[model samples]
Structures are given as C-alpha cells and as structure tokens.
Target chain A: MRALSGKVAIVGVAESDQIGRVPDKPAIMLHAEAARSALAEAGLTKDDVDGLFTAGISTTELGEYLGIQPKVTDNTSVGGSSFVIHVGHAATAIATGRCQVALVTHGESGRSRVGMPPRVTPPDSLRGQFEAPFGLPQPVGAYALACSRHMYEFGTTKEQLAEIAVATRKWAMLNPKAYLRDPITIEDVLNSRPICWPFNLLDCCLVTDAGGAFVMTSLERARDLRQHPIVVLGFGESHTHAMISQMPSYTSFAARQSGKVAFEMAGVTHDEIDLAMIYDSFTYTVLLSLEELGFCGKGEGGAFVSGQRTAPGGAFPMNTNGGGLSYTHPGMYGVFAVIEAVRQLRHDYLDQGIRQVPDASIALVHGTGGVLSSAGTAILARY
Target chain B: MSGYKKPLPKPDPVTAPFWESLKKHAMKIQRCNDTGKFFFYPRGLSPFTLSDNISWESVSGRGVVHAFTIVYQNRDPAFAEDVPYVVAIVELEEGVRLMSNLVGVEPDPGHVWIGMPVEIVYDDVTEEITLPRFRPVRAT
Candidate 1:
C-alpha cells in the first residue's frame, strides 16, 4: 500500500456561516455556506475544485448546490466518521491522479430540524429488525450500556468518566464560538439529570445545528496556497457492527483497528503524538477511544483521564475545541473534528495561549459513527 | 401488523421466515453448517461464514444478561410510556447475543447485575407480530 504520509495537504478549513441555532436555515444551505468559506480560505473558487465529498446529501446534490461540476465525488455516509474517511479517500484520489482540489463538507440542522430529510432505516434492515423492536435506546442509551459494561468489566468509575466532560468544558471557555463555556465540576456531571443509567445528561454530546468543510490537495499545490499546509500523515477507517448489540466487545471496537492502521501508516507511535482530537459523542466515547487508540492501556482510561489530566494545564491536551460535549455537535461531527485539528495546527484559535498545543507538530483526530459501529482515524502533521 | 402501536418489522425475504416463526411463537436463529456458529437477528447467510449453508434451529432459549441500562426518557413516543425500563444484552447458550428488555424484574442497577440468567418469552403485541422479550429464568 502506498503510504499517505505527507503526500496531500489540507489547505483550508472552515465551519458553517452560523452554528448552534439556525432554525430557519436548511441543511443544504449550510453545506454550501461551509463549502464557500473553505474554498475561499484556500484562495480558490468552486470552479477550481474537481472533487467533492460529503454525507447525508448526495454528492450530486451538493455539487449542484455548490455549482461545481466535479469529476470525482463520494458519499460514504457511514455516520459522522464518513467525512474523516473522506480525507484518506481524497488524499488517495489525488495521489492516484483521480482528481485534485478535493472539497469535503458536512452540515446538519440537528436541533433546528429545518430542511432536513427524513431518514427511514428499513424495518427489516439490520437495525430495525434486531435493534428497533428491542427498544435499544438511541445513542445515549446505547452508549450508556457500553459504559456500564466497561465499568463492570474493568472497574471503571462513573467519576472517572465524568472527568472527560469536565475537562472538555474547560477548553470550551477559550473558544469564543463554542456553544457552552460555563465551568462545570465532577459533581455537576453526577448531579445532572439522568438520560440513561450510568450516563447523566451532561455525559452526552450537545444537539445543535452546524456545518463544517475542508479542502485537500497535493503538497505541491498547497505550498502556493495562502495558509500553512497541514499534511495528512496517515488515515484509516473500520466498521464492525451497525447496532451496539453486535459490538463483539463493549470496551473495544473499530478504534483499535483504525488507530493501529493509522499509526503504522504514519510510522508514528502514541508516544510521539503531541495532541489528539478524538470524537467525543459521549464521555464514554472519549474514554474508550483513548484506550482503544493505544494512548493508554486497556481499562486504564479512567485513571488516565482522572485528576484533570486532559484539562487546560494537564499533561495531555484533548478535545480543545470543547468537543461534542460542550462544543457544537451537529448530527455529524467528523468534519468539525477535522476543522479543529487543522485550526490547531495553524494556530487558528483566537486564544492560542489556552487553546493551542504549544510546539504541537503532530496531531491525531478520530471519529465514531453509527453507535460505535464505524471508526476512522487520521494523523496530521504541521511541517 | 396493523394496529401495532410501536415500530414493527416489515420483514423482507431474508427475514420473512424469522418473523413468520415469531408469529407462531417459535424463536429460530441461523446456524452455519460449516462453522457450527449460531447467530441472531436472522440474516440471509451465516454472519461468520457468509455461506448459504445455514439452518434455523431451536435452542434452550435461555441466556445470561451480558449488560443492561435503565432508560429514564426516550424520544420515541412508543417507548415514552415505557420509561425507566431495562434494556439489556443477553448472551444465549447458542453463543449469540440479543438485545431485549428485561421483564419480570425492576429496572435498577442495584438489582440487576451481569451474568443474571434469563429466558426468552414471546409477547404478542400485535396480531401478526410477536416480540421476544427476556425475563429472569427463575421468574419463568
């Protein structure tokens, strides 16, 4: 396999025109808005783009909306991670000469629910037949089950899990665009209303309307662009189960495989990673991803994240964009994750003193989609 | 399937047999002849072997609760009336897992623990559909 290390560069990244709450705006408009912002940031126009990738809406629809006749397009909507996987796809597509100037976009009116199409998972489909009838609760309920099992198996504590939420909110305080910046404590998390057993309302990600976009091209082309190029070191994705029931193991899932592939492809180890922007759909997700990504040993996620280790002044800085817990969590957060990783690499945060990872050259971002059924990991480096 | 209050499975060709058997109050899962593996949520072929050499067979219908969660609230109206319910993953003797609600037991973390024995029981919620729920085996 051809190594993706430093082959392609992310020239520009941006979020939708407005996030948090745009009740009157449609989903497609957010897509177009983010796309225009990202393309302009790259000092390029839609006419210069030859490839487009996104989820929820068809690439053709997005292409038409953006008014670009793309020669290559992909709509791998596994969930939020779909866009993360697209980074690797676009990189390879550029490497293989499929297309240049690839644009990946995501926009969802999660809370506003305006101009969002109805999703119908066929009743006889894997989810509807096996999971729907069982009253297997949505994301929170399903993830709580995993957290409960992880605690039972590894002696993980709820307080240890609460540390993740507490630390992420601390990062949100530095981000002016963050949806929630109020300081919270472990007790606040525990006292929060219970959505599902083992998971308080604070333990879950926020529901908001948002969009994000990214532009990828060859390193040769990116150097001429206006912004510092964040290289795509390596990327990997995995899908094991659609429903949480078939997850094989609660504590371990696709993140294990995806992380391994990404690390090997990047030729980097966990010890060398300066920062990690992991998908924080739920607090348990951050904990388990840390463990599965080999940042820490199995069942040590609780101890690793304890004592504000990932907080502002902690040893390891993670989810500095506040994460889905406190950051804006549209339906799909993969693109937002990529956008944050790029911004951190470019020192784009307004308050770099608190938000930036000092001397942060290598960063890793991962996304979990479809109830932990699918996972994608990307290794980015600023040279 | 009419008059069903909750979401009902419109079984396709591959799953029609599974739902048909459920209507008769008999639970069946596909067993791969090659690998001798039993899997649930009936599929067209063995999930492991991916071969058509499969057979639907009956087992003890007894399983152990692998994990569980008590839902305080749900967005679906169908489950709004059933708040504070126990949704659990049960590992059957056949070595396959099934997601079902724990019946005949209260939804409490202190009360429910892993490895709790459970058995499948059919709940005829609609005329053409029968839901398979699990209860503590002792309560059966």
Candidate 2:
C-alpha cells in the first residue's frame, strides 16, 4: 500500500448555513452556494475548477446550471459517504495529473424536501423489498436491529449510546453553524422519544437542509496558494451491500479492512492521529467505527466509549464540528466530515470560542454509507 | 406461519420463496448447485460461484444461538404490545443466520449465552402469515 502523501491536498473547504427546514430552497442552490464558498476559501474562482464531483445532487443538471464546463465530472452517489469516496477518487486523479483542481460537494433539504426521485433501490433480486415491507423500510430501523444485537451481545446499555449524543451536543453548543446548538445530556437522550428501539430522537442525527464542499488540488498547485495545504495522505474503501441485513457481521464493520490499508498507506499508527472526524449518522456508528478503526479492541467498544473517551480534551478529539449526531445531517454527511477535518488541520475555529485540539497535524476522516453498508476512510495531514 | 399479515405486494424475486415458505410454516435457504455453498436472506446468485445455479432447500429450523438480545423495547408499532421481547440471531442447521424473535420463554439477557440450543416455532399471527420465531430448547 503506497502512501499518497504530498500527491494531493484539500486546499479549501466550506459549507452552507445549517438550517432545520429550507422548504423553498432547491437542493441545487445549497450545493452552488457551498461550491462558491469553497472556491473563495481556496483563493480560486469557479473558473479554476477543471473537475467537479458531487454526491446526492444532479451532476448534469448542476453542471449545466453552474455554466462551467468541466473537463472531468463524477456523480458517485454511495449514500452519505459519497463525497468522502469522491475525495479519494479526486486525490487519485490529481496524483495522475488528470485534473489539477476538483470540487466535491453535497447538498440536500432532507428535512423539508420530499419526493426526490429514487436513484437506486436495491435490486429486486435482493431481500430489500421483502424486508422493507416487513417494517424495516429504511436504514434507521436496520441500524436499530444492529444496535439491539449489540446490546444483546455486549450488554451495551442504552445510556452508553446516549453518552455519544451528549458528547456531540456539547461540541455543537460551541459551533454557531451547527443546526442544533442546545446543550443535551444523557438524560435528554434517554428521555427523548424513541424512534426505534435503542435509538431515541436525540440519538438520531439532525435532518438539516444544508450543503458542504471541499476543493482539492495537486500538491504543487496547493503549495503556491496562500493557506496551509492539508494533504491527502492515504485512503481506503470497501462496500458490502446497500441493505443492512446483508452485512456478514453485525457486530464487526468492514472498516477494519479499509482502515488498516489507509493507516498502513499513511505510514501512521492510530496513536499518531491528532484528530478524528468519524461519520456519526447514529451513535452506534461512532461506537462501531471506534472498534473497527483500531481505537479499541473488537467487542470492547461498549466499555471503551465510557468515561467520556471521545469527549473534548479526552483521549481522542472526534467530530470536533459536533458531527451529524448533534450538528447537521443533510442527507449526505461525507462532505461535512471532510470539511471539519480540513478546518481542524487548519486550526480555523480556534478563535471562535471553540475548543481546539492544539497543534493538530494529522486527522482521520471516515464515512459510512447505506446502513453500515460501505465504509471510506482517509488520512489528512498538514505539512 | 399463520398469524402475521402477508408482506405488502412487491416483486421480490429472490426472496419470494423464503416468504412463500414462511406462509407454509417452513424455512428455506438457497444453496448453490455448482459449488454446494449455502446462503441466507436469499440472493439471486450464489456468492461463491457467482452462478445463477441456486435452489431453495428446507432446513430443520433448529440451531444454536450464535448471538441473542433481549430487547427492552420493540421496533414495530404492532409489536409494541410485546415489549421486552427476545430477538436472537440463530445459526440454522443449514449454516446460515436468521434474525427472528424468540418466544415461549422469559426474556432475560443474563440467562442467555452464546451457542445455546434453540428451535424455531411458527406463530400464527394472521390467517395468511406465520411469523417464524425462536424459543430456547429445554435441557433434556
């Protein structure tokens, strides 16, 4: 596994206002806004973007509307982790000299918008439709099954899951851009109405109408830019299935296989990671990712998350931007994960009354798509 | 397989047999004709051979609990009445796992252990549908 160090860098990152409901705003507007913000952050305009990569948005329609003909464009929609996978792909493209600058963006009014055309339902050949009609229609319930299984197998109490929500809400309180900044507690998480067994309303992520984008450029190009470049050190990806039940192991994640590759490629160990931006579509996700990413041994995630390990100033500073659990989850959260990693590496929010991980150098960003179905991990470093 | 409602009419080609078998109080799994590999939650093709030579076979619906959980909360609104239910992933005799509710026993997590013997029992919730649930097999 070759390290991608110094081959490509995330030059800029930006996002749209995190709002609960933007009924009238088209999804494209959110994407365009984030795109413009990212270009500005990179000290470049839309004209400098030779490639466009988008997730959860209509690429052909958006590309036509943006009025910038891109030499390369990709619309890889792997659910929430689409943008993170795009970052890996864009890094490869930049390394191979296919495109100098690539923009990866995502936007969705998932809270307010309704009736978006279904992109790819699991094939009729899969058991998705059969199980879907049997009351497991979406990923939430599917993940709830895994949560229940986790609880049964490991004696993981509901309060333990609540700890993740409480920790994330505390971080959200300091993030002005976070959709839900109100302080929350384990009691709030426990008392909040249950959406599914083991998952309360607070345990679920915010359904925001937001967008986010990241601008990636070659290392040589980024070196000439004004701000410090966060280089893409390494990345790994794996996909099992779109349906949750198809996963081989309910307790273990396929992320270990990918995370191992990424870590090996980056030439860094888990101990060297200064910051981590794990995708938190649900509280259990973070717990599972922690175990899979080698933060703790297998089956020890239940006990590892106790004692505020993932909280601010803890052993690991994770999801510093509040994460999707408390901040904003506008359908595809992969873009926001990268955006926060870049910010943490750049030390951008230090003066915003937010607690910062001092001298943050290397950050790991992970994205899980489609009901624990696909995992993408990337290592970002500031040099 | 008599009590639960029939699943909403949808074209689930691969799992039609599994569902249709459940209606008859039986459990079926797909086995690859070429490689003799067994798979569950039915797929259109065999995972090992990638061949479409797959056929449904009935299982004894008897196995050990690979993993089990006593849910203090129920997921479906209809099952809300059945709180504190036990759902276990039973590894069937055919070497495939099925997620089904455990019945006919007190729901206690402490009393359960991995590799505990279990057997499937059909609950006739509705005339057309029989829900396959598991129960702890009593010690001989």
lDDT winner:
1
Fnat of each prediction, in sequence? 0.75, 0.13
What is the C-alpha lDDT profile of model 2 across A1-383, one tens digit per residue? 47456589999888864455777777888788888888888999888888889876667877876777887888878778778888888998788878888988777878877434553445254543434334442566667767766776777888888888888877788787778888877888889975666677887888778878889998888998867899988888887776565668888776887688788888889889998998999899988998898988877887877777778877778898899987789777889999988988898877865468788999999998888988889999987
Model 2 Cα lDDT, one tens digit per residue, B100-133: 6667777675676667789988766565455577
Candidate 1's C-alpha runs over 4 A off are B1-4
Model 1 agreement with the true structure over A49-131: per-residue lDDT tens digits: 99999998999999888888888888999998899999988998987889989999999999989989886667767788778
Among all windows of ten consecutive residues in candidate 1 chain A, which has the lowest summed lDDT? Answer: A347-356
Stretches of candidate 2 exceeding 4 Å from the true structure: A1-3, A118-125, B1-20, B33-35, B52-54, B63-90, B99-140
Clashing pairs in 1: none
Candidate achieving the largest TM-score: 1
lDDT of predicted model 2: 0.78
lDDT for each residue of candidate 1 in B47-136, tens digit (9 for 90 to 100): 787899999897777889998999988888888888889999999999999888899898988888889999988888887778778989
